[model samples]
Target chain A: MAELARLQADFAAAILGPDADVGGLGGRVEGDGIPAPLRLNVYRNNFRQGLGTALAEIFPVVQAFVGPAFLKAALRHFVVAYPPSEPMLYGYGAGFADFLDHFPPAAQVPYVADVARVEWAMHELQNAVEEGVLTTSALPEAGRVRLSGNVRLVVSRYPVASLWMAGTGQLPPEAVNPDAGGQTAAIVLSDMEIRLLPLEGGIKTLAETLWRDEEPDAAQLVHLPALAGRGMLTDGETQA
Target chain B: MPILKRTEASAGTEIGVGLKSQHYQDVVATSPALSFFEVHAENYMMKGGAHRRWLDAVSDRYALSLHGVGMSLGSVEGLDTAHVRRFRSLVDAYDPWLISEHLAWSRTGGTYLNDLLPLPLTTETFEILVANVSTLQDAIGRQVLVENPSAYLSFVDSHIPEVDFLAGLAERTGCGLLLDVNNVFVSASNMGWDARAYLDAVPASAVGEIHLAGHALKEVNGLPLRIDDHGSAVSEEVWDLFRHLIRRVGPRPTLVEWDTDIPALPILLAEAEKAAVILAGETGRRKAAHG
Candidate 1:
């Protein structure tokens, strides 16, 4: 009904901008030290609170980087652009990193997006299917049948791995300057956890094909991977 | 939806604890002396995966209750029949011992605040709930219990007292009441009303489950505004209210709900055990007094 929408709009307006004419909500406008404005302020606070908590949950690393105040301001911007469309609050906040990329404020911090991407990957990885991966023994005796919710990965950049390591306290406080970096490799969320290693292109292809039920006619790492490949890590010898 | 059929005189069922995922192995191993496990219906609403996997694992061992926080039962708009259908499917799949929702509404039109929002207790609103509950119950093909809310503010236009409103709801829709005692204390204290009187007003016979939790006090302009925050241990006053309530209503299924700032599993178990002690004491007293 028009009345309900008006009430919601008023409530929203009162939340976003208290000076706006927020009218016709069921609760009172005054008399108990509670202005309609203050009531709406509480709602605004809750709105911010919900999103803020959710973002912190999803990107604790990013939150650490930006700190609470910056994150809070970023979230205020996000909520205006991306109010939740569904009741399920857990699965929200997919657009923050991209939003940051275009955001003029974060222009100085260009690599924030890359860092956010890492955090988002970790977030997604947490919720990803935790099926059993290929065992070490299974690696030798296997036809590449595609591993279950599992794969091995290799990143060309050790700095990404070191950055992750530095963030996670796996490595010491050796600040990984991405500019002054040796090429890094990672396992990349393989083994159901983020692992960084030299990019192994062939075995990952075999795994991906197997995972997707595609048995490509190749016993070796046929992808001609740049840094690392999974299939038959022989010493630079091409298969006959 | 309101309950399709409920026996007011029916004996209260066994107590249940909210199922947390971490305790799956411990619960399976220990088989602790719990009456049942209540889970957020939405949590296990997934089709397959760990939520379903463990729920299936534990389903054989315990009675399950489906308590939903998202079904905006008191919304002015008609119930989301899709939600009702999903609930019905879950009910069919899980076959829970009891199903319940809040007296509060969350979604209005299409947007969802996802908080258990307060509703004005009035004749018009009653009509809305009656229709919504009836429709939801019909869709779900089962009965439902409605829990009372923790209200922060009162509406001047609202003529009906919350107790009467809730009791009236149960009467009209054939629903059971999940009497949240801490909510009662908080709402009563915040609004400056008599909680004992409100408890007396709510017919004891209509209640199916009892909920107790801690609250935080917010002094909004020196008026003690008790926020129904289940973050810490049960307050002495809330415990006192609980003792008073169960003594009157007899030993019903009670839960010590600690949602925010959830402590370790053992700490939660200890809190539940504390409630059990009170329940045991009351049970002993009743036997001595009545028998």
Candidate 2:
């Protein structure tokens, strides 16, 4: 058992570590016509390509914003730094946004991390379980309401929603200005489609309050019907 | 958890395709005439979403096979209890006709490599696999089939052959075997073993399912190596190997696996059709032999 564990550790290190150190582990593999290092490269390519492709799927908008080459380089570092702790690939890359925040190459593009956050939020909401819609009639006149399980609110300093839309080709690239100021976007699943609605003023406050699970004031309640109509708000009742 | 018995009506000996998310709407709408659809257990591990909805719709119209990729049955550290629970939940919800996982390890030291990493065919690794497979079977309350992995390199310390290792694992755990002919062909070619001889040696009754897929050939250090990419159609060599196995073991529930560069739905169904034809011929041959 100890020997097997050591071999696995060495093999994993040879794959995830820098390419210069494969010789040590390669000696353990049989070179039946093909060199041991070349055989180990197969696993190296598979490991990087598999996780790289998964990150590309999860953060396509980021790929669009930073281009594939830059995303690939960043992914090269992100994967080793934050290899998946679980088997579910969809749940992976939750820490990518934070990784990009500290990435030196991405320092020039200050809004890319926020863009990653928005993309990750969309990814999570898309996979979130569908919940019963909160009908307008079910709302109590003066009671607490909560955001649905499938709703995500990403408040960013930059125009994150416009950036997302532009990256998705919904809006032209020229339509978004990174310095165009702060934006609060509500990502919700309604009518079987994930919609990103940029919020402002009392509506944004109402969403922020509900997302935090706090009671909304009378002024904020004015937008309650709007949120309920979009199936974004739910009564505070726990689901069975 | 209620145990769903594998009745003959539900476990038909027909060919199926691996269900991809890209063809969910097409599959649900067209309802193609395939025996069963195989899905990666990790892909549908979510609590709810469009994936579940599409899978529910497709499973409603056809039989399902739960093919897991990340269980890491050969991990020396032992099985992940949380992953087993998720797998059990999926089994209970779908009540699939067949359930299987790879005889490889992907997770180690709490880091999942996201690829079916190879394991050395030794007694130590074999014991680990016995324990893990038994744990999974006990948790799901059903027998699980362990599939062979495509190998690129062999371990220097390994003394046992790959076929004997898998056969021993099945014998000890009482699990079935999923004979991936493409894997067999690739491993045999890469390791300089006789692919047909390997098939001839497989214990026939333990093979509950078979997989046919494509592989890509690349030259490493001027030596030819076959990589099990599963990006294209099944090669003629793999088809010949599949025929050889079916001729020996009769018909099993076969699946056309195309994981990378997935083509259109019709293209996948066409591959499944090819397997179905071969399976039909094998069935006729078996009937004649029995009579």
Candidate 3:
């Protein structure tokens, strides 16, 4: 009975990646007329396809940017490097953007990683808690006015969000500039819809500051109305 | 002693279809007279959103069953306390008629694969399941059902048959069983076991719910492997077994689960209707006998 856990660990290692000796566990299925390696492959296929499909769902525009073939090649390496931590797949690909950044083959498509970040932020904000817009009455008393739980500030050296919007058909294809300059986009839920609002210099700093729970300075506070006007602030609480 | 009160079990009759997000509007607008709608509990494991709002509206109109895929009940370590709490929150919010998790492990050492991986039917795994089931029921303050999994291959150390293993787990933990007929057929076919005998081994009263779903056939090393992909319509063989089991166990809350390549709501409901015909008769007789 005690040997079962060891076997599971060995088996999990075998199916999860190329590492771990399947020789011991694979031998067990040999007597069943199904070779142990073949049996192990079934789970290998299931995990790859199952987690791969999930990764694809979260980073669709990234898949679009790199093309399906390249994306799948990248996923094969990503799943093994960082297997899902939990079963709720909604937020599983949070690290995928980082994975793509270091992924060798993806270097050709330099903006692929940033594109993934935008998609991940959008995926998160889409399911994030919706809140009522903060009112003027609530602003003065609050020491730090936090953005909505769904607000995500994405700063990239490329116009990744625009490319994603164009790729997903949210914006006209002509609006997308693959070589466009760096930009900051705020992924937030507005009007019950996920929106990517392009942020300027000051607004970008304010968004980042508010997201980090720090008090925005006068320079950043001056941009609050612009952000507030866009319904980005959801909670206004005075900090001690 | 059970820590929580048991929500009344679904009379183990009637047929329900899984509520997919794609079909949420239809479910709300049409309000199909389904026996109930089963949803993946993890999908609704959120603070607030359209998902919960829509589900709240739907629950008011119909019965709900919370089928969880992420608890990893069969993990060696134990049930995740946080995950269980989240599940309990949903249960409290909806007061679902049935709640279930698989008898397979999806996590080991910390990595969660998100797929129901097979567990060896050993005394060791049995004890783990019993403890996890007990902990989950106590945490949720209600009895939860454990569903049998379809295995692609058998473990060499597996000393216990799947049926007796589940029955013993139930007897020890006081948890109910969610007998998935499709799983029985898939596992039986994959491992060369008699599907009918497997059904006979399960105590009828332990079954609180039934699941019928489609499976994909794959060939591994020249041998047939039935994968419980739940992609297409229920096959003719699974329907036959479902019919045989329903007669033996009487009516149970039957759910038509189409997780992949899910067709339209009407198509899924059509499949549920087929099971409804079989259930309608047996459920009527039971109601009359009780009255």
Candidate 4:
């Protein structure tokens, strides 16, 4: 048991680190040029490629924003720092935006991290558990409305929704300034398609606040019907 | 957990294709006449939505096989109980004919690498695997098949050979073998072993299914290293091995897995058809010999 633990630890180090000794794995060099490290390299490549590919899928907007070559290089470093802690790759890149925030190379694109956050929110929202949301027709006009599990509210200092839309080819290409102030995106699933509803003023706060179990502010009352129409309001749990 | 009395193989002598989301609409719309559709259990672990809807529609028409890649049954830390329960839920929802996981570890110490790592064929590892398999079987209330891994290298600390390990595991845990012929070919080419010997060593009655997939060839220092990338068609070499093994073990349910660079549904169907023909030929040969 101790030997197995040590072997795995060594193997992990060898695969995760560039200069770790792989001789501990006890792999003999096959033909003349076939080095043992090269055998280990296959695992290293698989580890990087596997996680990198998953990140690429979850953060296609980020990939598109920075281009593939830059994304690949960042992913090479990201894999070592934030290796997946779960077998399922769907939720693997949750911390990727934060990783990019501190990464020095991606400093030029200040909004890259925020964009990643939005993308991650969207990704999670898509896979979030689907429960029966009350239609607007059955509105309980007297209490705090609960949001469906599929609702994600992303507030970013950049127009990430538009950037994401442009990246996904939902809209024509337009110049998006990363420094163009903040925006709130209500990422909701309507008719099984992800709709990035750009929120403003009280509605944004209401959408964000409703994600948690809280009473809507007096200012948010005007936008409650709009929220309900977007299938964000669940007509359940009347507050006493 | 009730014991799953798998008296007769639900999957008869036919081939199945790994159903990918890209080909879902076409597959559901066309309703391809394949024997069954295999889906990775992890892919459909959502609470409810389009994927589930699609799977429901497809499973209504074709037989379903739930193949899991994230169970991490061989972990020394023991099987993840939460994962087992989720897996059980999937089994309950979709009563798949066959369920299988790899004979490799992907998670340890709370970290999942998401790649199948080779396990040392030692008594300690084998004992843990038996316990893990038993726990999973009890949890899922079914017999699960364990697939042989495509190893990039071997460990000197390994006491038993892989075939012996798998055979012993099946004997102790009452599990079945998912003999991935491509893995046998890949492992043979990578570690310089006789795949035929490996196949012959496996108990024929223990094999419940077979997996055929294409492998990517990587040149490490000018020597070929067969990586199980599942990005192309099954090589002629792997096909030959599959033919030989099926003839030896007789035909179990075979699957053609293509995860990356997934071709059109028609292409996957054709690969499965090829496997079906091989299985059919084997059945015919057996009947002729019996007569």
Candidate 5:
């Protein structure tokens, strides 16, 4: 058992570690005409290529904004630094947005990380279980409220919602301006479709307040009906 | 837990294909005449959304097979209980006719490499496999089939042959076998073994399902290496081996897997159709032999 554990640890290191260094693991693999290192490259390629492709699928918009070549290069680094902890690939890239934020090469595109954040949020919401929405008539007047399970709030300094729309072809690329200040958008799954609803005025304050689990002030209370109508607000009831 | 029973009447003629998200709408609209649809269990491990909805719609119309790619049954660290619980939930919800996972391990330490890594056929690994397979079967409350993996390299210290290892696993744990003909061909070509001899040695009665998929051929170190990419049509050699196995083992529930570079719905169905024809021929041969 100890020998098997050592063999696996060595194999994993050879694959996930630096290039061309198989250590003593190379001799453990059979060499039939093909060199051991060369054979080991097959698993290496599979690990990098397979995980890289899965990450690309999760952040297609980021790939589009950064170009496939750039995204592929960035992913080559991201995957090594942050491999998935679980087998479910859909929930794989939780740390990607954070990685891009600190990535030196990605620093050129300041808004790229925010875009990744949006994509990650949507990816998460898309897979989240649908919860019951409180009807506008059923809303409790002056009490605590919460965002639905399927809704995600992404408030970014960049106009990330428009950038995401352009990447997904919802808006023309020319219509989005990166320098157009900030945007607060609620990514909500309504009627089985994930919609990006931009929030402003009292509605934004109301959402931010409820999202923090703090009671909305009187000024933000006026927008309660609008939020409930969109199926974004839910009664503050803990899930059973 | 009532397993979806595969009756003797429907044994040989059923042909299924890998369920791809690209073909979800078309499948819902056309409802193709497939015996079942095999899904990668990890892909649908979500709590809810379009994937679950689509799978529900399709599973309503066809028998489903949950083919897991990430169980890491051969891992020395033992089974991930959380993963097994999630898999059990999926089984409880879908009640698939056939449940299968690979004979390879993909997770080591804590990180999941996302590719099926080969395990050395040593006594230690064999014991690990037996323990993990037993745990998985006990958790899911059903017989789970273990599929052969495509190998690019072999461990030098391993003395047990791959076929004997699988047969031993079945004997010890009462698990069934998913004989992947492409893997047999790929591993044979890469490891310098005879594909026919490998097939001849498999315990016929233990094979509950068969997988036929395409592989990509690449030259590594000036030597031919067959990668099980499943990106194209089923190779002629794999189809021939499929015929050879069924000629001896009789027909089992067969699936056509095309995971990468997925073509149109018709292309995948055509592959499944080809397998159906071959299976039907085998069934006819068996009938004649009995008569």
Candidate 6:
């Protein structure tokens, strides 16, 4: 039992990284039919399979992009790069995007990491409880700043949504003409549905007004040019 | 006709759900009409997190059960002590109402597959199983129910029947049977065997609980295969099987297990309610649990 524990810890550590001492389980443990390294090889395959399958579940975009065989190899690297901890398995591979950034083989695909971030966001969104959208009718006289985990985030990015679309099969591979592109405004929605709205020429300022938990009174000009010029409120009709 | 007369012994009071993170908050908050909640001990073999928090919260509310999927209780290589220690620590920490693992082997020579694989019912395998279960019971210091697994393939070398294997294991180690009814349907359909006869062979008193889950049917190499996906609702046939089972077993704590494509809480709760109804009507209600 003691020998097995030492071996298991060693095996786990070896899988973690090179700079680990798994009670000599890092090198070899000889046996018949399947020798020690051979056994470890099986563990390596199974470990990769388990973690890879998990990653596939979370990031179908990456899986679809790489296809099954390549995805398996890529996931083998991903697993070693990030072996999951227990209990918190749902959010286990949280650091995967960063890992994908530094990963040697995947370094060529700069977009892969960004794509992973979007998928991770989707994974989170699926589990996140829905909240009411920000509205101006119930405006607070005093504007306060808050950054709860449930805070609404509206991101205006250049081409990240396009990349996400292409990766997730929402926009088919051909529809995503790699040469043609455009930036989009997207809310990091936390719920059953997710949408990507391409930012119009004038949405930036409007988005900024309600970006925080504050009222739109001070930043009211961001929504209307006349209000900004007058330094006063605009009529409800002007919102349209 | 009733397969087995409803008895208080068969329909024990303790019923539980396999704890998943999705329902952690609800599990802690609104006290559901449940006798207990079971978590895969392997999932909580960590230091701390929501796993500890929610388990601690819900444990205070209801009886807890530590159901394990990784312990290769039927392994010929013998019990893994590190696994035992983790399970022991979990049991010591939670002090659950029930402790159990599968009557199957999933590892050999240190490469754990992490899936419960079935063992052929040979005399040799039986000896290994007996030794393994006894060792696990001795180490855990409690009688653990050995669960029947949903098998994909049947072995040619088997001598004893499924019920015989379970009964023998229980007899040898004084363990109980966590009879997963869905597994019986799956194995029977996959192997083209009679599920009823298999169910009839086992005495109701040996069973400790029942599991009802959905399975996916697939065609692998021109053969129909029923994979226990647990990703959907319980099938009509499986429901009928559960009815037959509870008619015999008489209102045991049956769990509605949906592991994938998990529907809303209302849907799952509704399914459990349906099972509760079946148990009440099928066998004369010894005790009525209000939802």
Q: Return the TM-score for each candidate structure.
A: 0.79, 0.95, 0.92, 0.93, 0.96, 0.61
Better of 4 and 6 by TM-score: 4
lDDT of 5 by residue, B1-291 (tens): 432334333565689999999999999999999999999999999878889999999999999999999999988999999999999999999988899999999888998888888889999999999999989988888889899999998998888999999999999998889999999999999999899999999998788899999999999778898999999999999999998888888888999999989999999999999999999898789779988
Off by over 4 Å in 1: A1-9, A12-27, A30-33, A103-105, A121-162, A173-175, A179-221, A224-240, B1-13, B21-31, B287-291
Give lDDT: candidate 4, residue A44.
84
Q: Model 4: per-residue lDDT, tens digit, B145-169?
A: 9999998877666779899999999
Kindly indicate the candidate among 5 and 6 with the higher TM-score.
5
Q: What is the CAPRI rating of model 5's predicted complex?
A: high
Clashing pairs in 3: B4-B141, B12-B252, B12-B253, B13-B252, B13-B253
Which candidate model has the greater DockQ, 2 or 3? Answer: 2
Tens-digit lDDT track of model 2 for B1-291: 332335334333678899999999899889999978999999999888788889999999888999999999988999899999999999999999899999899888988988888888888888999999989988998779899999998888888898899899878888888899999999999999999999998898788889999999998889899999999999999888887788788888999999899999999999999898888887778779888
Candidate 1 fraction of reference contacts recovered = 0.16
Higher-lDDT candidate of 3 and 5: 5
lDDT of 5 by residue, A122-239 (tens): 8888887777788799988566777888688878898988998998899999999988989888989877788888888888888888878787778888888899998897654423
Which numbered prediction scores highest in lDDT against the true structure? 5
Complex DockQ per candidate: 0.23, 0.80, 0.61, 0.50, 0.84, 0.03
Candidate 6 CAPRI category? incorrect
Compose the digit string of candidate 6's lDDT tens values, residues B125-185. 7777788877777776777877888866544446688889899877776778888888999
RMSD (Å) per prediction: 6.3, 2.3, 3.0, 2.8, 2.0, 12.2
Q: On residues A1-240, what C-alpha lDDT tens digit does candidate 6 reach at each position? A: 343334334545544543322245534443223233433443444456656776777877766665677657776776676565332345567788788778777755656665666677666645454443333343334443222232233342325567667776677777654335435333344233554444444444454554544544554434444312212221222110
Alpha carbon lDDT at B206, candidate 3: 84
In model 5, the clashing pairs are none
Per-residue lDDT of A1-240 in model 3, one digit per residue for the tens? Answer: 456667767767887766334655865553477766776777887888888877887888887667888888788788878888877777688898899888888778888788888888888866767777775455655466778765788888888668878878888978777688988888878766888788888888898788778888887788887888777887643211
Which candidate has the highest TM-score of all? 5
Candidate 5 reference-contact recovery: 0.88
| Reproduced native contacts, each prediction | 0.16, 0.86, 0.66, 0.49, 0.88, 0.00
What overall lDDT goes with each candidate model?
Answer: 0.66, 0.87, 0.82, 0.82, 0.88, 0.63
